[model samples]
Target: MSRRNVYLDLIPPRQAVQRACDALNRKELVQTETIPTHEAAGRTLATSVTARCSSPTFHSAAMDGVAVRAADTFAAREDAPLELQKGRDYDPVNTGNPLPEGRDAVIMIENVLQVDDSTIRIEAPAFPWNHVRRIGEDIVATELLLPQGRVLSAYDVGALLAAGIWEIQVLERLRMTFIPTGDEVLDFSQRPTPQPGQVIESNSQVFASLARSWNAIPSRTATIPDDAAALTQAVRDALASDAHIVVVGAGSSAGSRDYTKAVFEQVGTLLCHGINVMPGKPTLLAEAQGKLLVGAPGYPVSAVICFEDVLAPIAAYLSRRDAPQRRSLPVQLIRRTPSRLGQEEVVRLAVGEVRGRFLAAPLSRGAGMITTLTEAQAVTRIPTSVDGVEAGKTVTAELLVPEAELSRVLIHVGSHDNTLDLLADALMGLEVPLRLTSSHVGSMGGLTAVKNGTALFAGAHLFDPETRDFNFPFLRRYLPNLAVQVVNLAIRHQGLIVPRGNPKGIQGVSDLTRKDIRFINRQRGAGTRILLDHHLEVEGVDFEQVRGYEHEEFTHMAVAVNVLTGAADCGLGIRAAAEALDLDFVPLARERYDLIFPAEHAEDFRLQALLALIGTEAFKQRINNLGGYETTLTGQTMHPGQGLE
Candidate 1:
């Protein structure tokens, strides 16, 4: 082959994966080989597997007992145990043992103890399948076994061999070579005390592991010194070996001694260098005499990023390996983040429950920061042509983990509840990861979210001095025709949440009117804001006279956050949100925070789920444990107009 033919058509990871797949099409399996059914785990099926004989080939004992006809033990009971002649009326057999012909059921061995010579009695009647394995019970002949391209399991091998089948055809494994390069870097085994400007080498190990996990054989995983000559020799050795894909860890940069691109250019052909991506900007693609080559970064995080986002995808397609399904989710960005207009940026974030809102905190965006990935729950890709993304902007996140786990989460909008954390832990213990997205706008914010259909449900408590009613009035006023089922998640004391002790002589809503007091106010559209406005008009205090009234937050926890941070002198929220941050609460009035669901969505899965949560004795007990919460109306669906509005 000519030297020019040995060049990779360097492109984005998305394109590279596609290119490899196009180059290597799916091959049909026609050959079959004999393999021990037990050891053939994770091997793909070259051809369709079909059972030659029926499973449970004959009627067999399903339990360790005596085989007897159903009629024989029909009236057998404790007082009048029916006796039967051993071997004639009933034959004893162990579990999975073949039952003698004509037997319909088997009495448990415990029921038929050793009685007088060749005779036994059973106390209970046997039902079908209770103690018998019938013919073809497990499977039938000519049933499909493994489909083509399926990775074989140990159980599949057993089934194949049990069906009297021999070796089956499977796809060929991919051979990959990992080449680590850097002058200052040391091998994984070498505990080197490096001089200034030196760093420990770890990228090759990650590269190899990543490659092997994707069904690619790491035939040449090694850390090579950064000499163009040494790299040339290593590349020669790798190409000479059986490696189909050679990945160079680091050294793709255009800097001096960045010999990956240069070496590949000399040995084969350099298709392209650099993709418009953060951290992985210096990515390189090459082909050496028909073998694909990938050049990744030296940083451990960047190296792994490049592997999965770039090479492994191609390797999977090329090897005919099934590509794992990637799911995208619609998540609202917590705050504005900047990105280059023409360069795509992959940002990592730590998703967490703050109050009842799902708040995603941006992780360290440094290219070399491994902690960015360690702390991140997911990665969001910002496309080129968009310079920046605003806070609260909805963007699609490509999930590395399963999306079902995220969907099962309970999105709560309210003031922060530490109790929600407890609930989160309980749910997680049950293998259900409950995402408690707390947007702490306080009790009022939660109701507004329910009214707007912007959230699943909200946690709220608002004290109305006039009507002396709870959420019913607000629901009636704002969300008309909203089929609202008010399930009381909590009922906490409403009041002025102050610092440790009231340093200032502050009491009730009147103290917030003081000129020196810088008050933190909940944002407009929040139920808390409505209640605050109601109090302001009744108290005859001008909001313009108050400082920090225009300052806004989306949740109670956020208000507490600002107050705790000294950003505001005081704020009005639930006692829980206040106490959580060690602030003091002056009891104003008790209020109910109920979860409201739309009438049309009354039987929706989310509402059904909320009903189950409220109905549980454990949840009821928890609501009671939270000091002021009244569980009388808890789980009760207060019909529309029964509560507010």
Candidate 2:
């Protein structure tokens, strides 16, 4: 066994970017070329553009009327009308028409009365240069039309054409090549179904798309294996070509197989090894042949942060354009987000405008989960000095989506169910589409979020064995004073999810204690966990006797996955979850799953739309279609004493 290369002294991402920017000489690396003016939109100017010819080189008509010498119409008046001969006294012109020779003014057609084919009568006097576009009025010959380094827009194209600029000198679009590495990475172009321990390589495509958005040229080479010599050759080849930046995706960490640092050191000057950020800490920066070389982490989120925080700035500098910035807004945190003391953390948030204010719920923080980026409407940063942001505290968030879309987001801070997924899709089908963003933090967490006024609504299914009820008992115990409206989403069956064909022949809770039957459980404070405990008590099984009881998952689907993957023999979850993955289900108790909304937000349009959609028979039928769900009490208001009525 050989020791791997450790990271150099960690630096702030901004400082690393500045160091790269200071090292790369853009004038020597980035070339400029002449391109057609019409094809130069979104391209940066290499030098100031001067007009080749004056706009309206000759005096032209600015209005549709008659052109005549001012002295010819000076004596005309309302009381004494004057007659003029066509061509000699005046000439008819339309907008943008060139003025005839000797014409100094224009008599509007509305004021001129036609007497005959050769003559017309006029009552108003014409003034010099009236309704005329004078030469050099807009653009003067040899005048600066656009400044150097200006990013050309569509309007700039039209201006350039009018100024007689047929071609322009622009800085070349930055070229980047991404090389994906790893033996476990399957080529996405082949669309190969991934077996265990294999993953489809997609970070190259992500980087390519992001580079395109930055107006830079992006290409990818075939996947490279975890060979240091091969990676070094790839980097040298990219540098030998015209690529301004070279990126080696994955294998940048401290693992034995991670060879990016070694390859970078072999071919280039290592400017940075690690960043002082959470998801993007493994970022590497180096200069190879006066060009930027970036070693991005393997995780999707970390790669995105590396590209956005480090590569984007250097790219903008190379092309002489400002980096793109996202819109930002202050949003109240719906949950407590903890972070370490040293590294800055980026937290993705599901943000929505609720009750005339913006509310944000933190999504999953896993760097490998790209869905967090798709689901997040915004992202906030926890500074390196701070430990974390507390619930109900406001933080300024950089928006991933448009600000207007925030009002259409419906935030759910608790309990995961298959019905919620269906509801989310159904909401999007409405006349005014609404996006449902849910955070599965258990039933108790839902009540806590509602009490904190962080969520617009929450889903709950808390069961009370003493009262023989669900949700209401816990609501009274936890939230005694806050007024809320409870609406039943469905009465769902909860059961033990087992592998296909029930290889373990697990019957029910009685089988849970068997040494052969390793049971997976839900997290504490989860309604499903409570239900499992109640069943274990009834079956005379002690809590400590159940194997894998403490191996907890957060959602029903996750629990079912544990069973399906052979990690456990059986786990308790909703039948829908088992049915979803084609697993066997053992019948058990059924309970109500309800949506809780604060009474004050009863009139909110988003909440009202949800209520209206759920009340319809169509939504109920959809619920019934999911299998193992009873919609008899669906969309109806729930009371404390109402138990499965």
Candidate 3:
């Protein structure tokens, strides 16, 4: 094989997508198939479908009543009732039952008095066609039931079946075959416990699911190693099969091990080797052996971006359907987001509505962070010409969740606590579900978010050494003018989290300065970090004495995990976090954690529901079970002027 292509010839994402779509159209990839209409929901129609027969084939009764000739009861009145003999003047009929011969109307059973088995009396006149279902009322014979190119819905299936359409001609489902490559990739089907340097193959599964969502049939082949001959053979085999598109996972970059472009060249023509998009820049597109071939990056997030931006349009075109439109809404960005000037960036956003305005917080931008994709509620695109978006700027965000769900999201920005995850779960369990979206930017960061009007509330546990109090001292200094209600969420144990059995024999704060020990610290503004500083001051330990002090994580769970995984000897966090990971804990202090709510929003219905839930016995029990929380003051409220002494 020739040397790997050094230059990618990157093009804008739109141009790359259009090139794939144009190739699909030029090759006439779309085809049609006939299937039972009962199985046609979500499939696009190939041709206009017309009714073979009218619904309610014959005049049928619309209610459980007695069918009669309207002329027989025309003179009836409430004062003087009219009597008629059964079989001669009336016949019993149930809803959807065909009316007897010559019957033109129906009198509800409740409206008629049964005098005997053979007779009945009516108190009111029955008008012509009263409560009668007319022929062709719902559908007329030979009328159009669905237009060409229409996508079938569940209700459409019922309508088609009712109109005597047993089979329908629909656009054929686009068949996509995904081949994951790389010697380091392990098949998860074997349930293998991976050692170092081996990554479980998952990107192909992600592609398969995404393809299914776009109404395409997806099949994944066994994992292929990085050998060029094997990969070429797999691609050629896929092309020979019934696949309309073949996606090769990973090995798309310019690395010496990357051979996707070479394989494509051997089989057919390489259309484009790269796209100028963040996360998905290494995307490759090609047309070979009458099928489109795509090279998706190994990173999970990048793989998703490539599938959606490059392959989705081609699949839609081949399936004879329009591409799905993402719902876009204007949202206020919580912080300044930087992006490369020449590449179009897709920023995943954790979006929620606060104070009648939608606020979007961008998630981590790492291409391999799959959690960002799962947790993101929406994504905002930064055009290639722009450098980035500034804080407090408005941008259009494409929603991953329904737009209506944004109204139900409670925006919590501040210190990270494991209890917040439990609270989020509880809130979603309510009859009218509420979702909590929290950003772990530390206590001070959370307060800033509230002050900026981008958050409904903030989780804070700021410790003030001078006054020896929690939250209020810092709130007064930072948000003195903003009227707020501080509600205690928990009084949780703050301590040193060490590995199981305390293998390092870490005792207390002074031990953090020991030359042999490595410590993990929380982010600077985090409440746990503030507490750590207080202990270090009292112990007279210089910050420089502690090894790995600069290394930080945003959440207690993350800090504890680092210790559990042997990355650190100890870290300061809550006992709940230590207990969760089976780590040993050295007791330090118990501090108050509170939720700071804007005073004006105290009575907001959603906030009220959240507060009530916090005070519930079930919520308190859950906190107690976490093994480090005190619930006696869980929901107590304090005003701005009130100080904790």
Cα-based lDDT for every prediction: 0.68, 0.91, 0.89
Please, what are the lDDT tens digits per residue for candidate 3 over residues 1-645? 546667458897678777877666533566788999999999999999899989879899998999999999988998989998999999999999988999999999889899999999999989888998988889999998899989899999999999999999988888989999999999988888888789999897888788889988899999999999999999999999998889999999888889998999888888898898888988999888567999999999989889888778777777767776898999999999999998899999999988788899999899999989888899999998999999999999999999999888898999999899889999999999998888899999999988889898999988877777778888778888998988989888899999889987999999988988999999988988888988999999998899989999999999999998889999999999999999899999888889999989988878998999999999999999999988888888955444343
- Pick by lDDT: which candidate is best? 2
Q: State each candidate's clash count.
A: 37, 0, 0
Stretches of candidate 1 off by over 4 Å are 1-11, 24-35, 50-54, 64-94, 104-131, 139-144, 164-169, 219-227, 269-272, 325-332, 398-645
Model 3 ranges off by over 4 Å: 1-7, 25-30, 54-147, 501-505, 508-517, 638-645
**lDDT at residue 146 of model 3 (Cα atoms):** 90
Model 2 lDDT tens row, 1-645: 546768767889889989999998999999999999999999999999999999989899988888999998899999999899998898999988999999988877888899989899998888999999999998999999999999999999999999999999999999999999999999999999999999999999999999999999999998999887888888899989989999999988888999999888888899999998989999999998999999999999999999998899889888888988999989998778999998999999999877788999888899999999999999999999999999889999999998989999999978889999999999999999999999898888889888878788889998898888889898899899999999999999999999999988888898877888798989887888889899999999998899999899999999989988899888999999999999999998999999999999988999999999999999999998889999999999998888774
Prediction 2 global C-alpha lDDT: 0.91
Candidate 2 global Cα RMSD: 2.1
**Model 1 over residues 1-645: C-alpha lDDT tens digits?**
212222233346676555545443234211234564566677666678888877789888877888888876778788878788977788888988888887888878877767887988777777765667778777778898667777877788788887867666665677778877777777667678866688877777667677667766775445678677989888888888767778888887666667887788788866567766776777777766777778887776667667777776666666556665567666776657799877788887545432334445455577778756654566788888799788677777766556555555555666555456555555555434454444455565566656655566666554455567776766666666677666666555656767777677668677787877889887776656766777778788888877888998766777888877777778877677787778877776565666655565565554566577767788878766655456666677654344432
Cα lDDT for residue 308, candidate 1? 71
* Candidates arranged by lDDT, highest first: 2, 3, 1
